[model samples]
Target: MEFRYLGNSGLKISEIIYGNWLTHGSQVENDTATECVHAALDAGITTFDTADAYANTVAEQVLGDALKNQRRASLEIFTKVYWPTGPKGHNDVGLSRKHILESIDGSLQRLGTDYVDLYQAHRYDHETPLEETMQAFADVVRSGKALYIGVSEWTADQLRAGHALAKELNVQLISNQPQYSMLWRVIEKQVVPTSGELGISQIVWSPVAQGVLTGKYRPGQQAPEGSRAADTKGGADAIRGFLRDEVLTAVQGLQPIADELGITMAQLAVAWVLQNQNVSGAIVGASRPEQVRSNAAAAGIRLSGDIMGRIDEAVGDVAQTDPALTASPARRPA
Candidate 1:
């Protein structure tokens, strides 16, 4: 698999990163997770992304176990902080210094690794001072707990603030993980450009718009029995409302291009995202080994300029309907 430098950082991540969001701790068992990881590694996927909050912190433990017995030196591990991982208490959540410190130790224990290649803040924390958050991350990096630091779902203004704070404090902010996809171009206006200017790479999540671009959830039909949309709470309702028949009809128009390329619609959708230069890696969340194989194969399917244009026009500046939304391009900070 071809590797790309995450923005300007010297560290290189696989073009397709295996993300364990919903599948690792829910749909897939320990053995299945191990099988998927092995399948991904065979396909040249070296990077793995997970969060402490996903599956009540079980995703991290499951992912850690999947690779704990393997050669840890051969893998690039990435995990996120923020979100509540403790019993009902406000102090257990947010990006406060206390949570940051405690969270890393827990993550390290669960990941079965001394250090994560990249540690990311899952979201912004208005309650904590930017300086405090940056300082805590700097300490983690200095203490060798994490190799690099990143932020996710944070606005450009917050990104700029954190970047400037890190600069003043002599800490490096390596990347920003956001929901960037063909259907969700919000990052284009500010987050992408801002992070680019700051020399921060983007490890984009949900590059496929949660399977909408793959044309899996048809407009009128019930979601396929075992799809993510069906498993996720309110997922079917959300998709049915946002992904209308017009969108499906438009999606159908792109099938011919995918056919000509000898790739599935999911591959075409993933390939379309990696076509952009700023994207460091596309996080592919797969429940089954076959899905992982399909996504990994997408790394080689390059869409020509004409097909790219067709994809753009087909989707037509659609807004993301995912509940955990990211910054919107139209409302991006100036």
Candidate 2:
């Protein structure tokens, strides 16, 4: 597998990071999850990303059990905080010092590891002071619970503020995890430039637009059976926005491009995201082992400028490029 340094940091992660967002401990059985993790490792994927809020905090335990036999030093494990993981309480969420401090211990315990290679803020906590958040992250690093810090789905302005404080606190803020895909260009306009300038690389999620880019959901028809859009517990709600006729038709137009490249629509989609120089990795989630192997093949493929242009022409109109779309949710769940 191809590897890249996460931002300007010395830590190297696989270009295709195997992530368990909706599958682990929820959608897939434990044995199935273990098989997928093995498939990823067999395909040379060393980076794994999960979150404390995923599957109500059970995903980490599943991933930890799956990787228990592997050599810990060879893997780049990443997890996130923020979002309510336990019982609903006012202080159970946000990036406050109490939450950050308490969350790390729970995350470490669940992951079966003393430390995570990178710890991220799942979202910008509008209710918490930025200083307190960064300082808490600094404490996480100093305590050796996390080696580096990252943030997910944060706006460029929020990233800049947190990055500045990270510098003051002498902690490394090396990566940003955002929902970036051929169809979702929300991060390209502002977040990408800001992160590039601040030495932060993007580990993009949903590179296939939650399977919409795979051409499995045809226009003028119901979603295929057992697909993400059809799976209520998986991504039905998240995939709805991209299910419009104009968007699906545009996505269908990319079949010729994928055929010409001799790659699956999903591979084409993942490779399209990695073409950006600022993207360090593209996170792919899977319920089946073969899916992991197929996505991993896209790791080192380089798309020519001509192919990229063709892609842009295909989905440019339907793509969500508005910078305002990068804003964090107004009301986070407690």
Candidate 3:
């Protein structure tokens, strides 16, 4: 595994960040979760990404237990806020100042750590003012509960405005988390460019398009049992648009590319996402330790320029029509 800077924040995070969204409290047992976390650390992945809402907040406990005996200073822990973590209630979610402050304390307790390396607002909360969210996150940083701040699934305009607000308040928003993969190229339009301009690196989630680019589901076939496609929680709908025969066929065409490159389709897909200069890291979720090991190897597989061009052509035209997107100039190493 290789490491890259988390945006321009002077923090070097592993290229393959182990995401605890699906495995810890959802599929893997405690013993298995420990095994997977150990495997990631052995493979040089120092970053672990999770969220408060992942599996009713049990994921944090599982991860915390796994790393209980390890040196905390050596690992980079990242978790998100802004999702409902309880029975339906009026103030159960969103980026309100009250929620942000309360959520971090709960996360810290569950993770058994004094602070997380990075804490992100899980998504944009239109109901909450951006200034309030920024100020609350700044307070998190100042209080030493979170070292840095980021936002996930936000529009380019939101990122611009949020960063500006944080700057005014003397707090730096370090990164942006968005879905960017071979199957999802929407970020190429504005988010990537805007982030590049602001020096906020992208820690991309679902870099393989929720396993569609893994070539596991072929055209006109039933999804294998226990696969993400078979899952109902935020997984079923993820691949719904790409469930068509045409999309599956396109995915199948990548087999030769993977074979020629001496890598799995998943590895090829992940490496392709990391090929973009704007991408700081790719968060990979796995149900097993071997899967984590396999996915992390993607960091070493460099896609050739010609193969990248071929991939772009194979995926067909994808329009990025987000109004918040802006054009970006070439990126220079910081």
Candidate 4:
């Protein structure tokens, strides 16, 4: 698998990172989740990303169980905070000093690792002081609970302020995880430029727009049984925004490009995100082992300029590129 340094740090991560966001504990069975994780490992993936808020923290437990036997030194495991995890208590979320300190221990225990390679703030905590948050992260690094720090879905201004605080506190804020794909380009204008200047790389999620770019959801037909849109749990809600007929039809246009490259539409979608130099990895989650293996093939893919233009044209104006579209909760999620 191809690897790239996260941000300007010397630590390298696989181009394709296995993530268990929607599938680990909610959508897929435990045994199937383990199989998918194993498939990722077999495909040469060394990076894994999860969030403690996923499935109310059960995702972390399942992911930990899946990776329990692997050599810890060889893998880059990442998890995040900032979302209400347990009982939705006020103290159960946010980036306050108390929460950060307590959350790390719970995360470490659930992950079955003494330290995570990277620990991220799942969102910008508008209710807390930046100084308090960064200092807590710095302490996490000093305590050897996390080797580096990251943030997810944070805007450019948030990243800049956080990066400055991290520098002052002597912590490495190396990565930003965002939803980036051929159809979701919100990070391109503001986030990417600011991150480029700050030396922070993006480990993007939903590279296939939560399977919308896989060409599986057609324009007129019902969402196929067992598809993400068909699943009423969280997937349906998460993927609802991109379920328009125009978007689906636009996605259908990209199949010919995938056919030309002899790659699946999913692989093409993942590769499209990696084409950006600032993207260190594309996080792929799977409900099945074959999905993991197939998507991992996106690693090291090089799409030509002509193909890129074709993809842009194929998707047309259906892609969302508004910088203002990037956001986090105004208050901690309840």
Clashes of each: 1, 0, 0, 0
TM-score against native, each model? 0.92, 0.99, 0.93, 0.99
Evaluated at residue 169, the lDDT of candidate 4 is 86
Q: Which regions of candidate 1 are displaced past 4 Å?
A: 232-242, 317-334
Pick the winner on lDDT between candidates 1 and 4: 4
Q: How close is candidate 3 to the true structure, as a TM-score?
A: 0.93
Tens digits of per-residue lDDT for model 4 on 1-334?
9999999899999999999999988999999999999999999999999998999999999999999989999999999999888887879999999999999999999999999999999999999999999999999999999999999999999999999999988789999999999989999999999999999999999999999999999988999999999998899999999999999999999999999999999999999999999999999999999999999999989999999999999999999999988898898877
RMSD of each: 3.8, 0.9, 5.3, 0.6
Question: Largest lDDT belongs to which candidate?
Answer: 4
Angstrom error at residue 266, model 4: 0.4
lDDT of each: 0.81, 0.94, 0.85, 0.95
Report the candidate with higher TM-score, 2 versus 4.
Answer: 4
Candidate 4: where are CA atoms >4 Å away? none
Q: Which parts of model 2 are misplaced by more than 4 Å?
A: none
lDDT of model 3 at position 202: 92
Per-residue CA lDDT of model 1 for 1-334, tens digit only, reads 8898876678898999999877787777878888898889888999999999887789999999888776877789999988888573667787789889999999999999999999899888776777899999999999999888899988878888988888887767878888777777777777777888888888888877778778777767876887766765434543453467776667777788788888888888888878877788899987678889989998856778998888777776454544335632332111
lDDT of 3 by residue, 1-334 (tens): 8888987688989999999887788776889999998899999999999999888799999999888988999999999988788573667788889889999999999999999999999888877877888999999999999999998887888889998998898877889888787777777788888999998999999888778888999889998888888887667766677677878888888888889888999999899989999998999988889998999899867878899988877776542345444222122111
Say what the RMSD of model 1 is. 3.8
Extract clashing residue pairs from model 1: 186-329
Most accurate candidate by TM-score: 4
**Which of 1 and 3 is the better model by TM-score?**
3
Model 3 spans with C-alpha error above 4 angstroms: 318-334
